[model samples]
Target: MNSRNDRTDLVDTWNGKVEEWPKVRFGDVCEIVARQVDPKLDQYAKLPHISGVNIESGTGRLLFLNTAAEDKVTSNKYLFYSGDVLYSKLRPYLRKALAVDFQGVCSADMYPLRVDRDYLDPEFTAWLLISDSFTKYADGESRRARMPKLNREQLFNWTAQIPPLSKQKTINSYIKWQFDKYIRSRMAAKAQLEAAETLPAAYLRSIFQGPEAESWLILPLGEAGEISSGITLGRRVSDRETRPVPYLRVANVKDGHLDLSDVNEIDATEAEIEKLRLKSGDLLLTEGGDADKLGRGTFWEGQIPDCIHQNHIFRIRFDPSRFCHRFVAAQIASPYGKAYFLAHAKQTTGIATINQKVLSAFPLMVPPVREQKRIALMLDARRTEAERVHSALADRLKAIERLPASILSRAFIGAR
Candidate 1:
């Protein structure tokens, strides 16, 4: 196979590349080629063809059967053959596209690509799409829009280090072997997690939708708890080092849970801890964010003796005499409850956000006192199990994520 010799270092996203890999215009290595051959959008076709890709993992598939009605399969149709790469033009940052070996018609948003194996191995091309060079190319080509998109000419202009065909095949095989293990473990763990979540969510939904056979009143959030947003932690300067206060921001709160992985040290005395320090039963809610994240709340376990939140996060404290934190977390996680908050959210800058004044008025479904404790305990147990699965899966993924760097390092820096 005709190949290039300037081949060496391939590092992780965060790592610096050593033994500089040869640079070439992406067009040199592969061609963005596809053929259009599909029926126009008659809208009468009972089952139209469709394909989507998530660029992050290069996962793509064609709609052999209609699973959704929103499949906008219009006149612009492309023939997808085995070994063809499908690239999504929208939001390259998300890397939402994949490579597939199938014969079908797909959405116009996806571009069918043909990689020249003599210069670019199909698998290696997919890997390159997820590499740093592609990221830079994406940023350069992406349009200025809410959901960024890239044009064909821009895509063709993208460049990268083109490794020889033989080297590409070798790298492709090794990467595939490693990522396959990740995919299986990730898929299975994800399935187990989804199933596990349904249990608690179903139980919570039932409690909210009644069927509980118990009385549950709809009360405003302020009536149920102390509604308070966090203070904005200003940017830290170089001199701001020896500080007592532990500052937290939106990143610290995720997926209805508190993550203290990064704590911004601040300059605050003992008196500040009183105002900033969180309690074991504190319910942390996102103050302002996208519609889906409007009312997401998490219960803090009081890991840190004293820590504060960012302005974008809200801290909700329920009256111990009434609702419990665990029960409230479950309530907010449900569809109906979340919908209520999202409804009242004021959308600005393409994001739905609720201010302290509006959030205080957000409604909550308060079940009977006894049922609250019962549901809380039940969910607490389920959450523990979910946490176990999450921890295990995360450990496995983290371990797998390091393999690429290890392999690249060994191949380049004389380490095996």
Candidate 2:
């Protein structure tokens, strides 16, 4: 079946009547009026300069506009009036086109289209360009180009079903109403997601601060446990026999869990591997990179057998009889531990790092093993609930994003 004929027939059947509205070539109703001007000229230097990046895809929304002088634009641009529609010719699949309310100079990558008042409305034309039918046709034509650009000839030859002027205005109004609803829903979902993200920090602060923490036994980390650095990379060991072994990097360690997704292998002798191999319930902490990432780490569960870590990461093996690894990991991730690390960390430029001496001196608040297990269990339950809410909110935000294109398809293309 011919897809072009099928699209035309589908449009005709919208009202259960054949040929309810006349179809017309886009160029017949709108003219690409060129008024190219040098942006460096005194008259155009201060005007807001728009490019393809300025227009939001599938929603006719113009983002933060910058003046030609501020951007230091040195090329010739298409001069557009307040009522003109700016259509991006590059990457037709992005569906970037919008109606401007103020005069501006835009990059030549876009066309400044002026709709004939008697035949078409500017708002309706802007919406139609981002409609599903028009976008599909434009993408098909531009797909053959090396850079996926719609040439002038292909753009003008595009056809769409057009109703009378009054009907066109009604359709535009309906689309605008739907857009308002979509924006409100999106804003509410984003607010909920932001609130959910702050729960982790709050949970940590509640347990590690106040008079309750003062009653617990406090001990230095070096006296309570053993801390050792991992294998160093890029070292010469030609005389010694070596075998490839999987090792963790600083990137593999997260605040509360390990992301073993992209683990890499390094060449190390059997003796080096035996010394640095990871054990279940052992805590792994990073040296430091950014100020925020200082001493960030989580407990290892031995997910990858015989896996060792790089030198940038430190392994802490706590005494199993006295300390619960989960409870200790919870302390280090808390704001109290963060404050200690930040105060003792050596700063070079913007990056903060902690030496073995600083890490060994970390004051760990210790409770009975049974009490430690209870605290760890409570924190884990709260964290799990927060993550579940976060995941749900993120999925809702993604669904809300698809509303604009769906609304346009229903308004202009008669798509259900």
Candidate 3:
């Protein structure tokens, strides 16, 4: 990702492929290649100005929704129109810089250029840009490790093997067919994932929401969630490998349960482990925070036999008989819970902290335990299927990305 950020680089893999055919510089392709330079600032008009979001990998956004004055915006030097490719020349690891449609301004760091679409299929070229062979080189060659980048001069000079128009079109058609099929599969996956999340909420609402939403029992957080504190580790463990006690941090707690990645060992006596060791139903909450994270907590499914939560996280033990643990987990993940946490949170040294008082007083809703179990089961099944699609789409996207670089490898070197 670093190498691909700043410079125009040729991937050895793609280069090898291109060498098998007659090669030509990018300049020979068709025509029409240029970048815009204007609107020094305030380039974001009514149109959506792409930040990192415009990058496909970064989750592209077509609307520039921010109206605040404090948001930083890039100059118009990177403005692009539909069909033009705007790649993140900065870091190759971001692997995000790619085709952008919907005319708008972009970051100067991004290399935005109009290709000779007639000479080369724009779609075909997109696939090449995403190729691993080329991307890997760019990741290393483009920008510095911290911030990657690429420029126009090197990009224009990139060479590729030019097949006959007829041959090129045939190849494009095959790729397009595959892409079309992939798109349909991807759409289905998205639908499935959405269904997975929705079914749970619907299930809960069905069981709990009485006629006119007036009859179900509702209570504050005081009656629902029981608050328990995680142990304080004042001294850091010097030798993680030598330590026997597994410690949990905010990074390891995601969605629900303990994420193994954040688990670190600590020096603790048997007595300390007894007090700190987590039980099966304990929920983890953030006791501290950083700029990128709000310190919002997650659940630990008690996947491991024994592990401890750090001071930055709080242990929550809910009354499962009164409220379904799974439903409560989902509730905490809901938008309502997020607002409650953020609004009541106290900002100490720019870190949002949720105290035991507020934690115990929040309002909560619950559904019958039977329905909660059903909903959780249904959602898990759908989610699993959706995840499978997600994996496949990711693979297809990767394949499309590597095609152009593959073409280049053969064109420039005789290694295809």
TM-score of each: 0.49, 0.91, 0.53
Which one wins by lDDT: 2 or 3?
A: 2
Off by over 4 Å in 3: 1-214, 235-244, 269-271, 288-298, 319-323, 347-351, 367-375, 378-416
**By TM-score: ranked, best first:** 2, 3, 1
Q: Can you write out model 2's per-residue Cα lDDT over 94-139, one digit (the tens) per residue?
A: 9999888899899999999999888788988898888898899999
Scored against the true structure, residue 286 in model 3 reaches a CA lDDT of 73
Per-residue accuracy of model 1 over 271-374 as CA lDDT, tens digit each: 45567677778888776677777777788887876777666888888776688788888788777667777788888886887788887786677877677888
Q: Rate the local accuracy (lDDT) of all candidates.
A: 0.64, 0.87, 0.57
RMSD of 2: 5.4
Question: Considering TM-score, which of the candidate structures 2 and 3 is the better prediction for this target?
Answer: 2
Off by over 4 Å in 1: 1-200, 234-244, 268-273, 386-416
Clashing pairs in 2: none
Q: Scored by Cα lDDT, where does model 1 land?
A: 0.64
